[model samples]
Structures are given as C-alpha cells and as structure tokens.
Target: MTADTTGVNATTKGADAIDEAIAKGIDFDGTPIPTAKLELYTKVMALEANRQRSGVSNTMRSRIVRIGAKHIPQAELDQLLTDAGFAPLKEKEIAFFYGGK
Candidate 1:
C-alpha cells in the first residue's frame, strides 16, 4: 500500500476504506482527528477515478481549492468543516491551498 503525498489514503484495501476515511475525517496515515482544529486534507485519490466524470479540467491544487470552496456556500471553508462536525482547515492549511486571506 502506497501513501499519497497529499495525506490521503492510498491503500488497496478498497473504495469503502477511502470513503470511511473521508467520512471520519482521517488522514492517509489513518490518524484519528478533526475536531477543534481545522485543517483541510482532501482524499484526492477518491476523485482520481471520477475526475473525468466530474468534468473538472483544472490542476490538482486548483481542484482542491474548488473543493474547499464548494463544500460550503457563503461560508468560510474552515467554518463549514467545523460545523460539519469535522476539523476545519486552519489558517496555514487555508493559505497553503486556498490562499491567504
């Protein structure tokens, strides 16, 4: 099993494991987290098989930015994550991917 540099699950267990990680807010390292601290680390692999189906034509970073933005409408990406019962993206995480605000 290979680890995704993006910190997303890259094991060959199955798609369900990947989905579980996403739903539970776990990183590729299988770390149990995402509560008070906000940090966005998307499972890019999940979208690997569906990138064409989703009609996304941007680069990985751009796609991640879009995911952060689309997760919540009219609300800060981190705030939405926090509200969703998962850890929200911190300032650094936001700056790194979503740009500094």
Candidate 2:
C-alpha cells in the first residue's frame, strides 16, 4: 500500500503514525481492517518461509522486514512502501482512531 500523505499529520513522522496504527489496529485505509485480518497478518508473518538465508525465503524475509518497517513507522518504511503495493491511511481517517472508533 502507498502512504497517503494527504492525511498524515504534518507534525508526526510516518514511522510514528504507523506505530500507532499497528498498536491500535487503525486501518491504513479509512475503513477498519477486521481484527481477523490483523491476526492473520501476525500468523502469516510467523510462517517459516525459508530455512536457509539463501533463496526465495530470503526474499520473503526481506519483504516481511519491509512490512515490519512500515509498521515500525521507520523512515525507511516509507521508501520501501513507495515501491510496495499498498497505500497508507489518510489524516482524516486517523482521526477516527482518536475519536473513539
């Protein structure tokens, strides 16, 4: 997903935003991502994609790291997600989380 800059807080860094989103289960999209999906994300990431650091699993591992970084709200996550397929939530959308959603 792409980071939707339109909704990001000018004062908050992307990594911090992402961190809050993950901790609070705020969907990057305006709509709420069902908890099941969130659980699934946890489960999927737990899978042993590779045994050796030598092949396809390594690629998967890298992708997982990028995904984690995105959630980590790390500065690098934005760059990685720029090349990634999903989009981030908008600023207005994030308000719902604080609004008692």
Candidate 3:
C-alpha cells in the first residue's frame, strides 16, 4: 500500500492558521465551515465595526486581559502589561480574571 501523503494529519495551530482556514471556508478540523455560521459571524462583525468608538488602548487592554488570562499567570500577565506600556491590572480585573484560581 502507498503511504498516505495527503498531509491529513498535519495541522497548523494559532490564530493566523485559524483565520487562513476560515478564509478558505474550512474549519481547523478539515470540515467545511457552515455558511450559516459564516453569515452570522459576518453580520455580527459588521455591527461591531460600526459600534461607537472607545479608545484604542482601552480596546487593546480589554483584549489582552480577556485572552491573556487564559494563557498567562496573573502576576506574569500584570508584569507583561506594565512592560508593554499598558496599565497594570486593576483590582476588579484581578478579581474577575483570576478569581477562580
């Protein structure tokens, strides 16, 4: 039997990879992304794009806190924010993001 050379088991992981997959109309798992889901995502993103402006830094901080908390320890994340010239976490953020830990 010939070796399987389709690269079926090879996968790239990360946000860029996911985005590329989405742009190609495929899911990371190699399945087609349903048109309904794509349509809903596009609609919601359109709404977000037109939403009233908050400061760019505020938006950046929100995303960092939201996504960084999942991957970095609380103290490390706080230090990272400070080093990156962003505000360190506030007590409320600490309570919200690291409360369960």
Candidate 4:
C-alpha cells in the first residue's frame, strides 16, 4: 500500500516550524522605520517654512502678527519680521509706524 502524502501537511509543517522559531527567539522582518528622524524633520520643516514664506494665508498672518505683538518681545518681533524680509526699525517706529515689528 502506498500512502498519499498530500502537500497540505507539509505546508502546515513549515508553518509550524516558523511558529516554533518565533516561540523561541527568531527575529522576523518588521515594518519599515525611518533611518534618520532628524533629516525627515528637517525636510518637513523646510517645506513648511517655504510654504509659510509664500504668504499662504496673508490675512491669517496679519491676525496672528497683530495679536502676537502684544505678547512677544520687541527683539523677537523684530527678528521674525527680519526673517520675513522686512527691515527692522526703531522701537517707536516698530510699535507705531510699521506693519509688523
């Protein structure tokens, strides 16, 4: 008599071997992870900075700048304007005459 050794058993056996390996100490490949988080953050930050520079929401900019003036320091305000390409002005000029100080 000949035995019909179906491949389903072999498939289950292979799976069992894999499961046993995992139950012990075998490491399986996992989901992909970022290799350089700093680089990823830097790239995203640069894109966001460029988007902000393009006057993405100029009216929103005005509102925020308007409110922030009441809270931020004069030096910090001046630097923010400088980064946005506006020339810095004297203290009184910044507070009274300029669009953003």
> For residues 1-101, could you state the per-residue lDDT of candidate 1 as single tens digits?
53333535556375576666665566667665565432433444545655665333334434444566645442465565566555555556666554643
Lowest summed-lDDT stretch of 10 residues in model 1? 54-63
Write candidate 4's Cα lDDT for 1-101 as tens digits: 43333332344344465444333332233222244654575578679767745454555455446565777776786687678766553566456634463
Worst 10 residues of 2 by lDDT: 92-101
**Higher-scoring candidate on TM-score, 2 or 3:** 3
lDDT of 2 by residue, 1-101 (tens): 74444443433455578655555565555445578988887676567543345666556645555456435544344445446643443344334322243
In candidate 3, stretches whose alpha carbon ends up further than 4 angstroms from where it belongs are: 1-11
Q: Judged by lDDT relative to the true structure, which candidate is superior, 2 or 3?
A: 3
- Local distance difference test, each candidate: 0.53, 0.52, 0.82, 0.52
- CA RMSD, predictions in order: 15.1, 16.0, 4.7, 21.6
TM-score of each: 0.27, 0.31, 0.71, 0.27
Looking at model 3, how many pairs of residues clash? Answer: 0
In angstroms, how far off is 52's CA in candidate 1?
Answer: 25
Q: Candidate 2: which stretches are off by over 4 Å?
A: 1-20, 29-31, 48-51, 55-101
lDDT of 3 by residue, 1-101 (tens): 43332333256766676656656667656677789998898889889989997899999999999999999999999999999999999999999999999
What's the TM for model 4? 0.27
Off by over 4 Å in 1: 1-66, 70-75
